[model samples]
Target: MDVSGAGGLTDDRVLLGRTSTAERVADILRTRIAEGYFPPGARLSEESIGGALGVSRNTLREAFRLLTHERLLVHELNRGVFVRVLAVGDVDDIYRTRRLVECAVVRGLGQPPFAVDGLAAAVAEGEAAARADDWTGVSTANIHFHRELVALAGSARTDELMRGVLAELRLAFHVVDDPHALHEPYLRRNREILDALRAGERASAERLLARYLDDSRTRVAAAYAQAVDDPAGSAG
Candidate 1:
């Protein structure tokens, strides 16, 4: 769904009187990237996108700058902008952060002081997506589950950071050969972690989450390695 329109710029005045059009455009483009509509290494056609979205070139460039700062887009001297493809080191760092933050949150919830509703909800979402064979949905719910787990800490700052981390993580997932095979095994693991949290088994939950992050990092790193070793045969 190309969400650009000739009238969207003018309509923005009525929809959000004081909001910056460039910011709105950035949000739209960011969502598109996150949804994998623009795969890793795919060139972003500024002229075409600007025309489609009915925005000036300047506005589109601002949007590109914003995403670039978020590490979602990268610019090369002659190649314009493309969605970032995560390297093995990037994968390692992301998982390291996840383990440090998420495991700490789980460890603190020793007696279930916080509500498990968010965690439970994410688990249910993953389960439903799995039943429907929606691998993308499953992957989304999986990230949501981790996000919700971070929310247990009640820190807005951590939540914001995890959102960016998960978005980058999704880029890695977008390159995997089989979404179903990649994500199917984790649906049950999410449930197990949720159950541990619900049971107030803090140690058990932390252990499970640590293992999950470790496994995911290893799998994604291998996928990236394969892509680099054999670009022609790579899924991305």
Candidate 2:
């Protein structure tokens, strides 16, 4: 409850409508988790959120169950649901998945003149966020960049899978003590990857993405472990 808890509910209301269903509620909550509106360990108050979204308690509960299954939320007996704080191993697994999916997406490009406009746009988004000193926005932009990168595969199934995986990754990001350290270093690298894709250098783009995922996995996993192990830290 020390985190935003239910206090962000008023602002969150506009995200949903009176016609909201469980999946829609789940999607909104997932986006909030990724955006850090509900940071790691923040207790979710059912009354607040349900009232804000104009959804029934059952629908809200269903959405909570969905995110719980995704490893993005947890329900404790006698205590309300809370945003999940990922373990260090979870961090490693996330990056490993990213490397596998994202790199493969790039490697599968059979020839040149790939449609990389989305990637370029995402890169520009990150650059603009960086210029505005919006670190969280940079992180969001990075998410967009990766989403665009994976979109090149033209697989709806892969897109949904990566969306869940990336949302889980953002849970780990919330546990990180320094957002800038977690995201700033990746902006130029995103542009580099975009450039490679633009030039039709599939292999080059794949390698760059692989290395980027490796470095990020190392940094985030270590920081996350430290945050979890240190009693004074707010890992969850």
Deviating ranges (above 4 Å) for candidate 2: 2-19, 231-236
Best by TM-score: 2
Candidate 1 residues lying further than 4 Å off, grouped into runs, are: 1-18, 21-28, 47-59, 110-113, 232-236
User: Best by lDDT, which number?
Assistant: 2
Candidate 1 lDDT tens digits, 89-118: 887888898889888888876456458898
lDDT to native, each model: 0.78, 0.85
| Residues 117-185, model 2: lDDT tens digits | 898888999999989989888998898899888999999999888888988998887676777877888
Query: For model 1, what is the C-alpha lDDT against the true structure?
Result: 0.78
Error of 2 at 56 (Å): 0.8
